[model samples]
Target: MIPRMGAGVVRNGRELVKGMSAAVPIAIGYVPIAVAFGVIARQSGLPFAETVLMSMMVFAGASQFMAVQMATAGALGMEIIFATLVLNFRHFIMSLSLMDRLKDVPLLAKGALAFGVTDETFAVAAMDEKGGNGRIHPLYMAGLIAVAYGSWVFGTVVGGLFAGVIPRSISDSMNIALYAMFIALLVPAVRKRWRVGAIALIGMALNALFGLFLSGGWATVLATVAAAGCGTMLMPREEPPAAEKTAG
Candidate 1:
């Protein structure tokens, strides 16, 4: 059964409201960025329908922006698909992290809830102490997603429709913003492992070399696969902790 707040027992709808409240910050941030994506997409030659559909279906903000940028860079359709898959591989870890918290949820409920998980949503839900003593209810998560998702789509639509009024300079710069985000995400991991930095440069170099001869997106796809395979072989495996290794 879903947990409740207060003594007398609150309704499920109330939990959803709490979730919406929690997502306010995410909505605020998403709107401007999403709006920027909208304007950039329109300026980048994506039609309104495709722009909105990408948001609606993909729902991963960083990957969406990257997709648009890659398309602009002459990446082929298959290359774009493969790139997004590699980038979003982190979703596997995120989903696994939530498994314990939502373990008892029915499979269908789990499926619905998983669809709503994002970096923001996961962070919010992980820290949230709602639903009685640090538990998260499916409904609350649903509410959180509803607001965030709506804001993203709404901002995309607004930007797409208003692309003309927005300065061409601003929309053009959004193409570069996604990589800035990537750098921010990359810096922390690079700090942990120099191999990560080496692997990244290797991928970049490989792409450049391959792009000289390959067409469409195959160069990027091949480069990514090759770099990742090298990382797997070169990066050291993490051993079990000393205490855990000795416990049994």
Candidate 2:
């Protein structure tokens, strides 16, 4: 339904809520993994507050887990920063992809939006493209990021405060959520687009090959760039649907 000027506020509210609803699956996967990260950080001799603070600040799952593990081993500050910088190199690509898609979003808002573009959020936003307007609404993007960002911080607090209280077996098993969430997102897209499936397979193969010699960070970046190039050149491009003209 088209909203009157007065209803703009209500329309915005609905879009925000809708975006948050769409991210529930992501939250389910993230919370458990975040909790595990918190437990591991605490057990690895990180202070409880710092563990939660890391989640709030870094917000990158794999990097956070790796950083805590590295820190536990008595790594130097510069070493930890360099390792995380390498690990999170993929964020550069993710940020660029989002920037292109969100042409209508405000310039000031883009930075905040980019900060929230994790792997899961990027996947969901890409799949949920706003075809009609050719741009995602800023409020929707905000809500999506809010859920994911909030869940990680909240879970960290829970796990940090009660590190040993949570059973190690349960924390260990939470890793399954990570894989399961990817499969859940992947199957639907692959069913609709064979090219997506093919590109995914190629990425996996290239990552495996590169992993043999390169560090995981470098391997992932290279494989992703290669697979993206493959898709760009090989996949058939479809133009956006034309907008229907209406009498003014």
Candidate 3:
């Protein structure tokens, strides 16, 4: 059997409180960014109804931003739809892991909860500790997701309502918040593989190098390709333990 840990335990009321507390900065940072998304969507000629509908339906911050951008760029509807599918393909893997953790829950409840499985929610849920009996509480996972869902919905509304009031410089500064959120999400995962860390550093360097040379969004696309290549090449593979010799 794979080694197990209390990876899903809240430990106590305090740990639950701590996890919720950590989510506060995420909420605050998301406010301005979500607002920017709404403003941009509105500027792109999507009416409030359509904008809100996309937010509610898609429920993915990055994918929604990318979708709006592609739409604004006059990409075909099929292209936009395909791009969203490719971008969220990771969700399938995350869902499998979440399903194992939440296997004991009722099917209806599991189906409803699965809708909230975003990157942030998946990260929180994946880290929940296993219990002595190896079952993790679905409620803890739900609690984590509920906290993030509140922030996302609330931030979308705030951004939609106050988009015009946000200044250009303030909007520029918000980019740092995005970087901060990425780092916060990344650091923990980095501990598992030095190659992962190295690839990230290399990707950042290459992205900067290409950003200086190329125009438009080529830098991001190139960096993503480079990172994927590096990860596939350098990430370690685990080997199965040898079977014990039979006693003579």
Candidate 4:
């Protein structure tokens, strides 16, 4: 029993190391964006502590940017919350997909993994060969989450603390960095999947139309839903034949 337990511990540690290793690129990518968020939040009149707190509490990059923009635009509390909710709704689908792959994991671990499921992390996990077997090591996931979370939080704190020393012009220019990051994330996806480009174009057009008639937040939500709904309907679906399915 003692030997078995020892072996289990060693295996778990190795899994964790592998997970952290996989997350290195993601951590590096997050640092600049997290720093940008911190700087922008500070320039938008958020206190240093609040800026860090927002990073800690709401770790989603796009949502954090939206929150800061809405707050600065004099949006109501409910409006900000609703807009953030709509923006993050895709996480629900990501979590559901991971759930099927990680069903063997404990509920507590699943909850923790769910909290850490950012777009980058989800992409990493989904593309992993081990995920093809429908089993993801929880310890490895924990390691990935820990490193990525630490990098983001640390970067936010550093940026917020030093924001006061940055010149006003430079600080103002940092706002564009957020959009640049979004474009960087988008371009690769559009390249890999032509449908992504179509969806994005549709979303942009819908957003413009909606913006002329509705508030910013409402327009964004409506555009997202309309584009996604259209894409789902237009995208092809592959279904296995009924005889093959039964044989399996």
Q: What are the lDDT figures for the candidates, one per model? A: 0.84, 0.80, 0.68, 0.86
TM-score for each prediction?
0.81, 0.69, 0.67, 0.91
* Tens digit per residue, CA lDDT, model 4, 28-75: 988987887888889889999999988888889898988898778777
The reply for model 4, stretches above 4 Å from the true place, is: 241-248
Give lDDT for model 4.
0.86
Ranking by lDDT: 4, 1, 2, 3
List per-candidate RMSD values in Å. 3.6, 6.1, 7.5, 2.2
lDDT of 3 by residue, 1-248 (tens): 22333443425455556556645655665566677667666666677777777777777877777777767766667766665675576788887778777777898888767887888777666666775544556666666666776777666676666656766566545545445656765787798666777888988888798879863255556666777688788887775555543432
Write model 1 residue lDDT over 1-248, tens digit each, in one string. Answer: 33435432565778789899999999998898888889998898999999999899998888898788789988878878987888777787887777567767898888777877888889898887654656677778889989999999999999899998988877887766667666866788899999999999999999899989985367777888899899998799999999999996
lDDT of 2 at 23: 86
- Give the CA lDDT, 0 to 100, for residue 203 in model 1: 93
User: Which stretches of candidate 3 lie above 4 Å from their native place?
Assistant: 1-26, 167-194, 197-230, 240-248
Q: What is the lDDT of residue 122 in candidate 3?
A: 75
Candidate closest to the true structure, highest TM-score: 4
Model 4 Cα shift for residue 15 (angstroms): 0.8
- Pairs with steric clashes in candidate 1: none
Error of 2 at 50 (Å): 0.6
- Candidates 3 and 4 compared: the better one by TM-score is 4
In candidate 2, stretches whose alpha carbon ends up further than 4 angstroms from where it belongs are 1-3, 167-248
